[model samples]
Target: MLTANAAAALLDTEAEAADIRTYLATQERKTLLRFLTCGSVDDGKSTLIGRLLYDTKLIFEDQLSVLEQDSKKHGTTGGDIDLALLVDGLEAERQQGITIDVAYRFFSTPKRKFIVADTPGHEQYTRNMATGASTADLAVVLVDARQGVLEQTRRHSIIASLLGIRHIVLAVNKIDLVDFDQQAFERIIADYESFVSDLDFSSVVAIPISARHGDNVTSVSERTPWYAGPSLIGHLENVEIGAEDRARPFRFPVQYVNRPNLDFRGFAGTITSGSIAVGSEVMVAKSGRRTRVKRIVTYDGDLASASEGQAVTLLLEDEVEVSRGEMLVTPESRPNVADQFAANVVWFDEHPLLPGRMYLLRTETEEVSATVTHLKHRVNINNFAHEAAKSLDLNEVGVCNLSLQAPIVFDSFKENRSTGSFILIDRVTNATVGAGMILHPLRRAANIHWQAMDVTKASRAALKHQKPAVLWFTGLSGSGKSTIANLLEKKLHAAGRHTYILDGDNVRHGLNRDLGFTEEDRVENIRRVAEVARLMVDAGLIVLVSFISPFQAERRMARDLMGDGEFIEVFVDTPFEECARRDPKGLYARALKGELKNFTGVDSPYEIPENPDLHLRTLGRSLENMADELESWLRERGYC
Candidate 1:
């Protein structure tokens, strides 16, 4: 073993000799092993990383000086330096003393290099942690010796398992604080083992260490005679990451269509699963169109072939009708074309997620409207018990049924990250609300041999007598939804335009009668209305939908279904006091009395439109004025 003087000299010599510019220019690049450092706020993860980098001679003199100054300026009671400051980059993170974003750090050893994704340990940033672990091959889960296994610990472990990361090493840090007790280490390891038993993982290793004292990191220390496992660094150096699946059915979700010029047409994206070669047979999913790869192109040059984990662009022999958000897959191992699926979701927003709410589900490159069908259950992180839940609140995890507007080709998240994972976007605000993993796709049995209906918009219009369009009106309750809808229908009738008015209360009288005023129910009601409106649009009729549509997600869903220009959102900005004075159905009175739960203008949150195509203020406007406003909007939209 090297003496203290020798170790210090070795670190100094390497730091002085290091050249970051040369390393960045010609550094060896290969298959990177991604691992996440997860633990509670006070755990010693940051210290462990700092010690590893320090011992490996990766820290230069300038960085060390800065760290030393910062350490002296903000020294804790303990003698060890505060390493958390290096990773906690944001001002809010420093003030709150917590990590928020996923910080990525790169390092290299003689045998192999690594990229570590240090994820937030807070439960609120569970989705952010998931994003990091989604691309990782292994996970380094840290825990405090005194705290043992907390709820967040189990939650992170389960998420790692669900994401298909098989290798997990539980690093119990700060063992010195617990007197390096053998019993303490064994007890924590046994409890963690029991919790991980139900999960599908390849291996689990536990190591006890004190990041501050540098015990059992690069070398085993005599202080923990009872511990017999490899050190934390040793496990990482020896961990074997098998090559990703290159033999499964090939799936490439087109993120961009590389039509650089008239002669060049290519599909480009990172390969999420399988492999492809220049002459390989590929099929465009959903469309069931097959073609052969004419050439494999890349930024470097034309490649002979591409494998899993490689990002490349491919040129097909035929100029097929493929576009961004389409999937290029192998016909033999094609994914299921599904419109409805069950997914496990981690709700992030304060507004609880409820069934029947329409939100944009982005899978691969395709974005479509998805409705929550049912809340399966909420997971209790501490004990892993699943209880039936009706709604999922902020920082809650649950399983639910999702119904998309149209068929989408995808695989189970367990099968492929590129095809199985999706995000829920609010239709109105475009805010990312939730992250979901597809569990299973629902299928419908069809035996009918009816001729394929290849009807065009013109053919469909002949039956409905008008062009298909979505007229959306959004505002607070008692903002003339019913009145404006009635007037619009009268006007359209006089103009010989086929029209259908999906007046909110009228449909609730039959279609959505079972729904209530709760936030979850309201979301579902709007989703149902949007679906009906979409069908009416497909039937080639001028469909006018007048609803409060308080949620941004519901409005976005309607827009996605109709695409751009087909769906129009009109804002009716009437003051709450004025709408209440109208007392259209005594709703405002009920809301004031607290008889209505999640009322739009009461307990529930309403997202006001920032830029609606037409803004109509009903407070001071007469009935004729409102009608005239609607008429002008229709004319501008070419409805007349």
Candidate 2:
């Protein structure tokens, strides 16, 4: 109905739109690679990433304009348009000219889509570097050519290797500063390769680059014409990272148990690895209960099959004992099941990681009360040597033996990172204190078993004509904890109830003779006494435990050992000034005189209980009255 030129124009517009759609579809199908840059301070990690974003033409005009203005104000390059401003997005980072946190950026070339994390280079922020490396497929470890093979550079490489990054690109940045000397580049690469030889990396390719000037970043640099190798982006676009995830065994860590209605029950989680199809049988990792998958329900509808990274609700053919913090895996290929294992742990807390102290170890599908039973060795990341260490300090990596309260399912980190990685949480603060990768299950864990006895705790209590309980009396020295506990035990014994007392100083002479007054020893002291108390309570005796028990973590661990409502935490509330003034054993005087170390209420800290079953104040109340009050409360609850 129109002129020939108008009709041709309309057809051309439709064709152009179709071509655009096709191009987008191709881009969507391009393979995606996630990687991170890490190394020593001033290694140009941020600048290298900024160069990638700029060279790939991923920046908008407005962002470029803002960056140019920011370059004049905060850039380190003396009014030049500093490319690092593109990635150092934080105001603090720009002001300090340092990356304090992990800055993630996404960009793409025609051949591949990429996600890059620019990690901090400082030793204190090494935990942040480990976090960024946890999920990366490759690591571009930037090294300043002027400062070759620094300690932080080696440390980051170790963490990257530990976090399952098999491929590495050793980017010797700032090559221009050294006049692009081929010998200097080779020397740096040689030192780095020798240091990381034991890390078990599949590949390590070195490239000389100048991130600020964009040489050997996106394309070949004329300045480094003597070096013959693929540029950073060229190698990244062509590297072949296998689909190892889909090839591994099926592992679905159930995040939530979905029960929306009476008729429907489903386990909802993301498939961490491998493929799962409808009608495939899966087993609960810990329980070994197998069931056929009836449906793979997604928001869009039912899927016949689901692979790694897909979030869906899986309906089973039968109702199995599946819950949150459990895993559903292929029945034929089960993960390891053990309560004790050796792991490589990197401590992140300001407080050191003490052996035998209880922590909450949380894996992908399980959280359990665990302890570092032994500090095998600490890694000297500088030279890849193992050194003996009593505890793991901040940013320290150690191979340690961990024993859990119950068995969990996991694979070796080398076999599967998702199922093997875990984080340690402080019981009191609930903060993540450390990260670990499972090495292998200890033999003792698999060999030891709880041999059932004919006489149980209930039977013992029934024969004694009373209920068993652990009366944990905790306070500072000279706070009347032992005095009140002794009085309470005498009253119970006089009333014909079974009773026993585990005094702290008395146990140290026999049971805990080898331990010292260190913080770690104090934790061990409480653990041993709590175990004895539990055994006594199981033998039909009301066990009264009197100790300083300074840390709340150990107290909570002791409480966790007892059955529900069986452990009563009785806090003896007395002022530190009063305890110090009393100085019943002259311990505070010794501590104040710098003779005693780690003595509670003097040199050491005592974390007061947040909530206790009984709080007895010694300011006005007499010891006899406090003892009677505790006994009367127990009688009211029918515990005695």
Candidate 3:
């Protein structure tokens, strides 16, 4: 190694200094690697990061002095310099000796520049770890030597694999605590390999190190004479992160339409994958309009070509109606355009995900109304098993089917992360609640299309000389909803009104025969009935629906399907005690005897309607009086 004084003297010549500057500049242009550290709590994740920075001489002299003093005052290493203090920068973290958020650091060696994300180890912050791993090229998962492979180790490993991390380094830390025994290291490595056999990582390497003592961090350690492998920093600097994206088909999502003047019209966005050249044939994904590239424009100047990750503007030779939220791609290779897809999602909110509730889905520049149509299963992080689930709670990973109000242009997340990933935003609060990766579009979404007709709802209603409407009745079981609805339909039919009645038990005998009494099935049951009611109203008939749709979310879903003033929610207000005492079918008695499960009034809950259009108390009233009251209200609203 050259001395400091000699190195300064060598740079004294102007020509030599210029040559050295050129060499350093070239090194700065090398490829970058993004990785994160993850493991169980107190597994030395921050210590490993601090050791890399300390051994590489990246810390300044003043910072080192402060670190030495801080070590004595607050460090957990017992009077020695606590390397972990370098990474746990937050005051709370330093005081509590834990990492709660994702901390990012930037540094460079001669071979490569790195952006390291140190994530929390607690199970509560698993969503935070997923956020860090979304864009990572590799992962450094630490395992304590004494603990060997743990449940958290498996959790982080499975998450890293799910996020498409190609490389993984198993750093068995604190080997010095075990006297650097070769047998201990081998046992940990064997245990790790056994669980990771099902993962899709291209490379998995093991290294033994003592992060507190700075052993085998940046250089090879002499303590482990039987081990032969590159150090942690060596492998990071030399690992080959393939450039497969550069070879795939070009994809550019138009973010803005730049029309500075009458002479120019350009589409501005970043090329997310592959490259584009002037005069190449391109297609607008949303409109399926083909055009040739006329020019590539950038702030620097016009260019003949642009590659992946470059943000530029392109002018088309032919006039095309391309706008924001549309995609530009090669005609020969296009992504799937569909309104329904299957995806892997990680829920991040406190409120659990309930099906049929509308949420905002944003992918790239497109934002559309979406709903969780079905929850297929949730993954068991411990053993990678799929368990049946109706809803996803906080920090749960599940495979779900999503239904969007409009189609979007996207590729599989494995092919292009930029276009294939999406997030769910709560519509009311406008908060991001979940993140998802698209697996594939459902085959039926591509095969089905709405067939248009000349005669519409307006024409049908006009021909019938009446407005179409849906009268929805909701209440607890054993209530008089079915009785009142049947009488109201009979009254409307006598008055020359087109009417149809869709009762709960009648429809369940055929349309919803396969569904059970679980909460998930209950939501689905109401959804099917609401859809059928909507179809009948579209045919210009006043439809009457009677069901004990107990959940408020399901009721809201039905109301949202109809036009304003078209859906009338009638709450048949009858107390649960009154209904249980009545027990018209003896269902509540059976539930009380432990002969029935999921009985609405006996076991399950019934969410009362907060604000119903019509609240009718049927306990002390006659059926004819209730039916006449509903008929008078419909007549006053000009429905009959």
Candidate 4:
């Protein structure tokens, strides 16, 4: 226990400390601008930020003293100012003289406050650049005056646009080395402006400066009399950023369910759009389930409501089936559910993206299998033209069609980040291979009645036959699979079992002839064929499909669309030697000529089925015996 005088003195100290904290919080809350400084290597990104802090006198005496001491210890010349020493203080960064990670610095000016994200300028660290730009409101893309605009410079510009940053300030650094020529600055300005004219940036400001000599940084300089713009820091303090209006669709992708104890259950995520209040009705996308918000919780405490730009936890009145991947949005402004969309893609892998291969797509918290439908065109960065192209290799930018396994709820990337952006993961290595933005959902204009008629085209003939409906066939290629399918179709016609052989080759001649043999393309071909087969099955006709449907994943996907008894798999178990001897199309010979790549049973691997509903040895057995065996199998299955 303290005496009366001692206790009173302790109370006084506590009050003073509390007063100081209140003042700081008030100052921080007044800040609204968040920007990042990014550019090529040694282009003065860190030095520029350091000069802003140092020139403003924001650095404390102790910190400045330590910087001066370190400068002398490291033997860095130039009046012991050592601006780079403040940011590039890490031992590894100092030794390598390159920024490796995103470094955040916060400081306040009299006019406005700022938070600068200094990102690495290297090409391979595009993922790191993305991480820093993920939360920035503006970006200051630096270009060395001597080097003009390099590949990484264009790449950073593209990324900034993709990340939905509103403002871009092109800082022409190291102007002193270029004699501060006004013509040089104009040339660069005109070139870059023309390049990014189509990009969706609200504002773009160009400034010429020398970060090393403090020219045009903190105040006006005599070096460039032709330049009449505000100083670097002056523009940053006055740059008009359009504030986010959260009056649009409410989107909350549940990142985590905060279950601290049995009594507490809250949904936590960073709000991407609109607002939510207590008792506000919201619907979970896809499921279309509706619920009311019980309470809006925050890190500080429970609140009456929450708005966009604020990360908070939500409590619902009912324990709905909400998960991390599912999106919570207002029903009034719900997004479209689409399985296919067009997207602008940036490919970053060594191998080119081919059609038919499967990649895992992660949009917000949701991950699904996706395939590139087709490469529309490659972007010519130098002139900004879309060249007709078939594929995109490493470090290439292009537009393409992306087909997802399931329909996803999303908005255009221009409208919302939380529901727009997604990452593509390679299925084999699980690496993030590409990044994409949804352009538009694909739409096919056809009436439901028309589709119903297409399903009934062959149903009348099948019912007239005394046999039970149709015959279903399946197997791999180069195994006399199609020949057997043709023979069986003829036999079924003669026996009066209404059947249609949807031979893979015959259908490809019309529906899928434009498709290729790439892994990505092959999957799409199968998906389209499977949909057609399901429609035929609905018409009460047996659809026989004989294609090299390699993967079990693809086969399972096809089987899911039809009823249990509607689809059947027939295995054509034939030796490679016999099939090669009877090679009808000379495809096996072409595989041996090195003319084909990714050929199953040649260069690429093939997966044989472990079990099938009907198995047949097509090569050695007589055609009559094979037909008899098929008739009995159909009889057992009630098809004949």
Best by lDDT: 2
TM-score of structure candidate 4: 0.72
Worst 10 residues of 4 by lDDT: 444-453
In terms of lDDT, model 2 sits at 0.92
**Residue pairs with backbone overlap in model 2:** none
Where is model 2 poorest over a 10-residue stretch in terms of lDDT?
A: 239-248
The residue-by-residue lDDT of candidate 1 on 108-213, one tens digit each, is 7766678888788887888788888878888988889999998888888877876778899898888999999989999999999998888888898999998877
TM-score of 1: 0.84
Q: Can you give the lDDT of residue 623 in candidate 2?
A: 94
Residue-level error in angstroms, candidate 3, position 526? 2.0
For residue 65, give model 4's deviation from the true position in Å: 10
Please estimate how well model 1 matches the true structure, expressed as its whole-model Cα lDDT.
Answer: 0.80
Which residue runs of candidate 1 sit more than 4 Å off their true CA positions? 1-31, 91-96, 243-249, 256-266, 286-294, 298-303, 316-321, 445-474, 484-502, 534-546, 559-573, 612-614, 628-640
lDDT of 1 at 27: 50
The list of candidate 4 runs beyond 4 A from truth reads: 1-12, 39-113, 120-124, 219-222, 246-249, 255-268, 279-292, 298-300, 311-332, 337-340, 354-358, 371-375, 401-405, 445-511, 516-640
Please tell me which model should have the higher TM-score, number 2 or number 3. 2
Q: Report clash pairs, candidate 3.
A: none
lDDT of 3 by residue, 190-261 (tens): 989888888888999999988988778888899988889999999999998857656689999999999999
lDDT ranking of the models: 2, 3, 1, 4
Candidate 2 Cα errors over 4 Å, as ranges:
1-13, 261-263
